[model samples]
Target chain A: MPNQEKIRVNQLTKVFLKHKERVMALEDINLSIKDGEFICILGPSGCGKTTLLRILAGLEKSSSGEHQINNSGTDRPLQSMVFQEQGVIPWMTVEENVSLGLRMRHAPKKLINERTKTYLRKVGLTPYAKLYPKELSGGMKQRVSIARAFANDPEILLMDEPFAALDEQNKFILQEELLSIWEETKKTVIFITHSIDEAILLSDRIFLMSSQPGTIKEEVKIDLPRPRQMTQVRSDPNTAEIFLKIWKHLQTEVQESRTKNER
Target chain B: MEELKKAVEVEKEDLRRRQRSKKFKQILTISSPLFMLVIWEFLSQTAIIDPRFFPPPTTILQTLFSMSASGELFEHVRISLIRILFGFLLGVIPAITLGLIMGMYSSVRHFFSPLIMALMPIPTLAMLPIILIIFGIGEFSKMVTIAASVFFPVVINTVAGVMNIDKVYSDVAKNYGANPKDFFMKIALPGAMPVMMEGIQMGQAIALLTIVAAEMIGANSGIGYVIWMNYKAFLIAEMFVGLILISFFGYLFSLLLRGLQSKLIPWK
Candidate 1:
């Protein structure tokens, strides 16, 4: 028998109207993610990857179909989203930003303080805990965002291009740190990014999405070993082979999307 | 490589020049006011302007000292401060609350915008005669005039502050399951605070201006009353003293507000 399902989606669709034009952002999307799986959703811009992630995090209402968490109940699941822009509040200190979710839940002060310190240490931000967001660098701010989600101890972590703004060095370091955190916690992660290399390197399974009225066109499994490094992955011929395979599917969808828009 | 080395040296020298210029600018910024004061003193002592009409800085300082020794200056300042505090509370608290409500909801704002626009430009001081007739020339009229004067900017800026907050912050807060109170305290208030503080500072300055103007019309006690009394008596130095006190108090109030703003919104 298959392992217990962590999240299930049934014919999920999202429709939005922009400038008086009806746009279907996602259509007939059905997906099921297993427990402790790291799934990356890869798509072109405006392809509804973020929209799908938002729906999973219960941040957006879908136009149709059902989403169930852990096959447990209809209630919303415990999840946190790390936004593309590293949505750390500028007015708050690193510790306060990390502790915000706990504060919202009215967790005990002792518990919040302990978890905040733990996550700050994990993200290597303990030295700068008292500093405000404006004082931090872009990479450090994103680290704070990641620490905040981890501090929440959610059953699922949704990341929308969390490292999109950082330089290559910082991105690689954060990717490694994220992997370690996932290994320790085994929290199901739904990461959204447009970079195929990042998806192939970080995810256990990659869901390639087509543009406009986005649907999953392919789900490619990377049987790469755990504790993977970027350098090793790049050197592996299989990585480039899989990347081209995904790109081939993506290119046709991208062309069709452009052609349809031109009309 | 030689060109790059020369360019780096030139850049370093340019940075040093800029640093020196900034230091010189700061020194001039502090001393220019004192330099003007000395010039005014020299001109007045040399009889360029009639001392009777335009008292010298020394004479004004002497008058200030005398007023201080007698405790009369303190009495006027205390009374004026009390009036301002009372009026500012009355004006600012309600304006901020209502402005925030209007800012959060478009329908509410639309309903009130016409009335606000109609009333805002009527000049609160223009109502002094009517206010005096109703509330009489007592503290009540003075306080009401000050409150009315300060109300508009406080409401307008607060509304702008709320409207200008990034929707992303609010959306994140909602996604995290923040309730109304949490939303306001954590997301709304801090996000709007810099602008709100600016409004409070503006309201405070306007309140002080209104109090002095209102006192000039018919009042027994504030700095304005003293100025009017001394002007009628032809005590030019004393009138200068009152003018100086007003400027000093306004400057000090602004300095205090600046300190408060930095303390409250350090990130900004």
Candidate 2:
């Protein structure tokens, strides 16, 4: 039997030394993520959602905290991160970029090829396997990056607003695809985004954060059904109600952050 | 509209014909020097430009053939090539390594930048006399001079190559759990290859030029030595042959480097 708890974070804090001043980026961040859950960290820019995600991904060190991943001894849960800028290597072809994590892990060439091809097909990028990042559109590049993260078959997937650069239509389609892929893989996902609609649409739970020395202000459970359609979700009264509640909390933080930034 | 369509068709046909003609012209252009040789032979036979001083192309070819048969031309070419190879390797390897280090670490680059700036302005050829005096006009002196000629451009271009890489690539590598070796091999090396290859190309050309000049000053057996000896003996034909050989070797060397570059970095 799998452990119910996937990731546990206890009193995590991050402090940044900017010049001579010690600035806290995140303070007293504590959260427990259940297995196979989709969680979104929502906050304004500089609210330390990204900092929290980075710490979780082991890319950045926390000032003080404890984090543990429950793998049940089957394997160390693989973690993969997707960035906003679409971290596809410009020199590599789409397929090559998709297989990079596997290659890094020293996976056999045949397995890498098979997994890369499968993921490319899933992302609707099979035809673009030979195409370099420079040849792809913004949406296509993001798809490639997502496919790469998926190809790793990670236990936890961290995304820092991966689709924030895409147009609405592309974003909707990608969101649907992401949900479908997540349903099949059941990976624990920690997505950070500034979009309220995105958080409401995708997350099983939204961890709304407050600005400056960021701390989780509230956690909103999403009781919507599976295989959610964006159109239906938008039209559904419950979705709109949840979005409005999140927005009301976010608006004040946004205004305060803007004023602070200006100063 | 009909006329315009017809004109378009005609223009396309003309373009196709022009492309074919241009290809043929390029082939002819490459062989033009050889054709000039034929013309020169005929002109010399018909008594033009004093056959003694400006030898006919045939005479030069014959001299080249005789020299090769006697192993004289081969010896000179071998010596010159060995000198260039040694000098280039000595200069370029250290330059690239130092350049990469300096580029990756800004503090190191800052410390060395002023030193490089001061040293770069001194021409490689100007140090020839000092080098000869120190090293005693031997093969070492010639090799060291050639190495010096190749070093600066390689170092400068290598630093530029490393510095110009996109920061996003490095960030991506870091985010993906890449260690230092993986980051350098996968991102930094490939990213900077194009500029580094160009630097190597420049270094190669400089190496060849410096080697020849160094040979002229002190070497006992090289193309430059041949040229100098021929000139002193008033053997203008032999001197011209040496000049042609130098050009041919330089051209071949460049083509070789370009081919290697294309093969190594097909994407660039």
Q: Which candidate is the best by lDDT?
A: 1
Please, what are the lDDT tens digits per residue for candidate 2 over residues B35-72?
88888888887886678777888788888887789888
Per-residue lDDT of A1-263 in model 2, one digit per residue for the tens?
23499889999999999899988899999999998899999997889998898787777899998887677565433588888865778878888889878777777899899999999999999998997788889999999989988888777899999988899999999999999999988889999999988988899999999999799999999988988989888888988889889999999888888898799
Per-residue accuracy of model 1 over A62-108 as CA lDDT, tens digit each? 99999977633433337888987748888889999998888888889
lDDT of 2 at A47: 92
After TM-score superposition, the amount by which residue A263's alpha carbon in candidate 2 deviates from its true location, in angstroms, is 5.4
lDDT of 1: 0.87
* Model 1 misplaced stretches (Cα beyond 4 Å): A71-77, B1-20, B129-137
TM-score of each: 0.92, 0.81
What RMSD does model 2 have? 4.7
Interface residue Cα RMSD of candidate 1 after superposition: 1.3
Per-residue C-alpha lDDT of model 1 across residues B66-178, encoded as one tens digit per residue? 98999988899888888988988889888888788777778989998898889999988898889888988778788888888888998888888889888767767766778
